[model samples]
Target chain A: MNHHPTEPQETIVTDMPDRPALLKRWRPRGAVWLAAPAVLVLLLALAYPLAIVVVRSFTDPAPGLDNYVWFFQSAVNRTVLQRTFVVAAWVTLVSLICAYPYAYAMTIVGRNLRLALILCVLVPFWLSGVVRTLAWVILLQDSGVINSFLRGLGLPPVKLIRTLPGVVIGMTQVLLPFMILPIYSVMKGIDTRLLQAARSLGAKPWRAFLQIYVPLSLPGVYAGAIIVFILSLGFYITPALLGGPRSILLSSLVQNQVLSLLNWGRGGAMGVVLLVATFVLLAIAAPLMRQKHSSTRREA
Target chain B: MRNFAGALALTMTCALALPVFAQETPVAGAVKEGSLEGKTLTFVSYGGIYQDGQVAALQEFVEKSGVTLLNDGPTEIAKLKAQVDAGNVTWDVVDTADLPPYVHCGTLFQKLDFSKLDVSKIPPGQVGECSVPAMNYGVIFMYKTETYKDNPPQNWVDFFDTEKFPGSRAIDGSGDPTGGLIEQAFKAAGGDPKAITPDDIEKGIQKLRDLGPDTIYWKTGAESQQLAESGEADMIMMWTGRAMTAAKNGAAYTPVWQDWLVVMDQMTIPVGVKDTDAAYALLNAYLGQRSQEILTEKTSYTPIHMDAKPQVDEITASFLTSTPERIAQGYQQNIPFWVENFDLAAEKWNALLSGN
Candidate 1:
């Protein structure tokens, strides 16, 4: 680990030789062609279709923002959107709380146990999200294996399938690796001597771990939380299978609009709203992420 | 003596079932043994066990006609429309849900050339301008026998009586609301099914809403079937074919047939598909007696052909929606009404979904 803090850059852009030299240093002109195919594919496959969706949101069934208006007018859409955010937030929080300790454990564990823990996260990656969700459905349904076990213990069976908590559990399980890996990598780089230094000086064990270790791992926490949160917003299968009607989220609403109602304009409007919300969220998160991460890395 | 009687019984059953077959001597849609050699027609359907059955149904045709049939799709209208719009249709024959043929008829889906295809053997009034019946099933409900034991829920009115029935109700949440259930609910609330209006949809939704915390809207046929198989819900409204599958899975349930909602899937050719004759031949073959029986046996959907007697098990036989008694009791969905006010009804259905 880089325990020696590096000095800040002393170079200034105003002292650059010329525009051409700076541009060359930034990126060579000849290297531009190498990115053409990827850019073209992105434009055709991603941007072009996304543009049509955005445009259709405005133009279809007569131009203007009527589709968005229609969407907002419906209480169902509002509740679903709210539910989507609430569920995503819960999934992120739960996974982060569950994952942090595990990730921390990974940093401290011996090689064999670390390998086994890493296998725990990576084995699930082999199964598709739908397959995993279906397995969860089988396990979580009424009179399922879980409930049967619970009943065997002489306790009332807890309702997990078709509930918000069930959806959160399914989603958190699926998204745990996203949370764990980033935090583990960041924790691996942080110097343990800093924690020991705090403990030796005056800080108690809890205070030292909280004050020294947590602040340093904030960057990984932010990275993982952002990924888990954003991905959860668009989750369909997990909630659809594990959640009841009360737990319907925004993606399923979009699916209902486009696939069921065949209302592309409304569906496009929902998609555009979700996209804009994500972008705005990223914009707000980026500066906070950068500032805290930079300050934390400096301390480390 | 028993073997002789069994043979005699089989012969008599075949004799009775071959009337429609007798009328079409050369088999109206049959081509010469190798007429379609080197030609390939792509068949698209909602893939899985159902699509597998469809492929099985066409095997005889594939062998006899030498036409290579390829399988693809869980049918999406947008994909079909795109192919037709681009005039590069790869999907030759497409099996779709009930609404698509009627909705996209002459635009995206081709008007059937009945000269090349024969619909005489298919059920009357089901031959749409652009399509023929793929199979017939119903939006039927199965009640857990253990839950009801003695006082089983008998009909739609009882479906909503949570106090009497007193268990969870799993309704079909497969996008569009089932018109049969709506009309039934409306009728149970002292409204006439034949005179159902836009306001009546709201009434029915209210009836469903009254079921309250006990109601669950199962999103897919498989989900509904799962509800039945596991007895997760005391009563589950699902497709007849799915109920059959659940019964096969050893679900202990009794199907309430008081007014099993009439339903069917349709097969249509995309407008710009290549090799229309080859497609027609396959469609014709799909309607034949042996093909219908095979489709029925494999998929558990009742055949649309008038005289195809599938040798199904007792469970499948019970689930068949096309039997004379079931048909007499069946409540046909007001398709014209539904198609006209689909969006408005969807608004109410969505509201009901979110109310919980």
Candidate 2:
């Protein structure tokens, strides 16, 4: 608000030091000391375990690159990897498509109504992942609720359990909250006046949304998609329960190797591959996120 | 500013030390200085009758030792690896599936000392280096007695002879990859289940593949029961307890114990536990004849103690697959064959299960 220039030169310069010293002066000594405990927790809880996995990946099971070789060359590993990415991509895209309208409705709706709808979405979110997945199984299994209803209506039951579509349905239901909340938060921040201005300029309602609202909401979409993808990549129970023989994701493969096969080396290697794939995806996403955000803002 | 720092320091101290402080209390001893009271000892186990059975069996231990048992369900190796990798080993005595210890033994599980307890109290050959048998159950054929009133599937061959017993069948699609069901099928097909050298596990898998689209693959015991109860499956390769429950609930199911693939869930102490003795005590308590009887009464599992006998009601007696006749027909999981051929068979099994 203060557009007018005050004294331009450093007339009232004190003995207080420059930028680095100013930062140093404000730094709380106690917080710096307290950071030790927090750092220690991070090391213990997160860093050490990850380091162990990395170390185990190398030295385990007679020590060599046999496990890693096995992972990449083996048909099972390749298939699991392929299946994991396929499932993750589908889950992310589906979640985004389903969540976008729901999120938009939440932002434009009244506060009380929005809260109620959000709570409805979040009730499943609050329910344990296993419980919700089990509910889906009850609903979707061949002789389950849905199929029974269909049968009652003299319709043949569709194969819902142990199929890719079933996996998608269960996973999307479990992950829909992660998608909706982020988009809603981003939508809330968008100024309605921008949409109004677009309309005033003779843009159709859908056109204004596409040109203005959609561009503004991209960051949240990106965030939600990344989260859903990460979560979907690591899905075990949903796929294990609902997914048929063909739907084994990488995590399940890692599980079978470790528990069923008892090959820590191979399992760890598979885990490392999974971790690396996730990291690579994240790496691509991070820079892309920055670029997309900058371009979108520039367009606005 | 000083007050904020003080509060911050206190909060950090509590946050960092609370888990340790809460878990350091000895189970059977007086609380030590700076020890946590009411330390939670997690038991990773399945729910339903099994969970109820475990609780019934461990009631005395809970009283004698002041350890709070936290029940986490079933064997999930991914979660275990995640927890171990995260350096937060939440499970103390995990009642897990048969093969997990072999996978995580020496790293995830503590090397058990059998010298202190009476291993003889266990069945002749059920003890492992890291784990002890929690209970014995099977993935066996269970048919609806009312549906197959003329004649039921007798054995593994009958299960495969679709032309003879033309109806939907359910089989386990989860758990161990190298299950004996397929091997038994191969054996019934005149392929030697015992001669299942690692090289032949593929043949066994092929035997399963031959079962083909007619087989409904049920993931959990509950799912298997659902398959049978809903009339989607006339017969199922089912967990004994699940079949018992289905039968009890008037689902018209009858277990065909012939060539049953019995797998034991063992209660083992994980590595990184500070109180091995307390864990052992719990294990010992779990093995006691009275406890075994109690577990049997509740769960329909044939508990390990040889002398343990429950006063079975007509319903319970009918469900008990451990009857001398049934026991004679059932074949134990070929653990020795599995152990020796684990590596090669494992690769082949994974390939097969993954449909490679």
Q: Each model's TM-score, in the order given?
A: 0.89, 0.77
Task: List model 1 lDDT by residue over A41-142, tens digit each.
Answer: 999999999999999999987999899999888778888888888999999999999999999999899999999999999999767999999899989998
| TM of chain B vs. native, candidate 2 | 0.81
Each model's DockQ score: 0.47, 0.25
* Reference contacts preserved by each model: 0.52, 0.48
Q: Model 1, DockQ value?
A: 0.47
Tens digits of lDDT, candidate 2, B269-341: 8776756765676777788888888999887788788777887778767656567876787787666566556
Q: What is the C-alpha interface RMSD of model 2?
A: 3.1
Q: Estimate every model's Cα lDDT from 0 to 1.
A: 0.82, 0.74
Give the C-alpha miss distance for residue B183 in model 2, angstroms: 3.0
**Top-DockQ structure, candidate number:** 1
